[model samples]
Target: MFMLKQQKAKIIDEVTKSLSNAQLILLTDYKGMNVENITKLRDDLRKVDAEYKVMKNTLLKISLTNVGLSIDDLSGSLEGTTAILYTDKDPVMALKVLYNFIEENGNIPVVKSGFFERKFIDQAQAKEFSALPPKEVLLAQLVGQIQAPIYSLHAVLSGMLRKLVYVLDGIKDKKPN
Candidate 1:
């Protein structure tokens, strides 16, 4: 009994630390995934600086309170074999990794819910987040969007200059020396 309590306390401490530093905390229910699959998922998540841990919901709830984050909206998804996937950096990249895992693994590891940037997102919303493009890709798209107008302006200006040159050439040709 004492050992179990100690383990729970340690988990609470770790979860508290993780939550305090995380930009996003995703809850997954890996009910049917095997150990090999879970390890692969963990390695993949590690590439994006995210971590996956299976913890007791009670300990997690205690840890949430320790980190000063209310677990009010997370209760609905608390049941089952839960694994916490969290990253201190880009949540979108982390979500993309998780999404890829779910996609490749035939969706066994289900996305339960998420807390991102101080907002409680449900399963649908978590899935939506996973569907998002990576930060670099989105940023690149924005840059392309911004540059399209500039390229058009350049094309218009070049056309005007070409017309001016043609006009000057026509005037010179019409003149007799």
Candidate 2:
């Protein structure tokens, strides 16, 4: 009995640490998935610096409370074969991996809900979040947007300088030597 209590305590502590460090926490219903599929999913998530953990809903609720998140807000998500996908690194990459895995596996394990950026998101929101492009791609798009106007301005200035130079040469040639 004492050993069981100790194990539960250890699990709660580990889950609490994970919750505290996670930037994105997605709750998935991993029912009807075989061990092979789950292992594959875990491997894919690990590639993107995310972790997939299956935990008891009660322990997860305790962890959420320990992490200062209101359990009421997430009560609905903490039900039925909860598998957590969590990451402190690029969340979009992790999401992409999960969604891709779902697509390939005929969507067996469904995303129930999620907590991102300290906000609770429903299943639809989690799907939308997964559809987002990776961080590097978004960063590149932002950089392109920022540089477009600057490049246009440089081109305009260069054209004006070229015209000025041409006019100056014409005037000098007409004046003599």
Candidate 3:
């Protein structure tokens, strides 16, 4: 039908555009998830600037071509209901949100695969990536770790100077006329 064709075209356009801009693209199985649940998940993803969409696999393939990505094995995973999760920045945030959603919902949704920096990731690798900390938290922890040695050195040096000053003050106080 005309409607189906039009929808396919629109989806191809969207997916092609997404592939060009997104830092990461993730595929998921959203079979048991209801519309309300999907809406909530979309809201959660939006809060962190990730995009979520359900699209036809054929359209996805066409779009993949536009973005110079090809997958020969995607047919197996493309059988069921499929949705894409993506972000232009902070791939880990998008993966984390999806992982948390699945964890909270007892696996109502499943991660199929992901593409990050032109590299494809299987479900297990995607899960591992998601298990890592968020970018900001990881950055903050790294900064703290890097600064800790400097802070300790400063404290030690200051303590020694303070002790030397106190020793000089004590000698001055005890000086005989």
Per-candidate count of clashing residue pairs (backbone under 3 Å): 0, 0, 0
Report the C-alpha lDDT of model 2 over 1-177, residue by residue, as the tens digit.
234888999999998887797888988999999999999999999998999998888888888889887777777788879998899898878888998899999996899887887688888888888889877889999999999999999999999999999999999999965
Against the unseen true structure, what C-alpha lDDT does each candidate score? 0.86, 0.88, 0.84
Give the least accurate 10-residue stretch of model 2, judged by summed lDDT: 1-10
TM-score of each: 0.83, 0.91, 0.76
| Pairs in clash, predicted candidate 3 | none
| Residue 45, model 1: Cα distance from true site in angstroms | 1.6
- Highest TM-score against the true fold, candidate: 2
In model 1, the worst 10-residue window by lDDT is: 1-10
> Candidate 3 residues 1-177, lDDT tens each?
245777878878877987898888888889999999899899999988998888777777778778887666565666678888888988888888888899898896888886887788889988888888888899999999999999999999999999999999999999985
For model 3, state the Cα shift of residue 121 in Å: 1.8
Order the numbered candidates by TM-score, best leading: 2, 1, 3
Which segments of candidate 1 are over 4 A away from where they belong? 1-7, 104-106
Clashes by residue pair, model 2: none
Please estimate how well model 1 matches the true structure, expressed as its whole-model Cα lDDT: 0.86
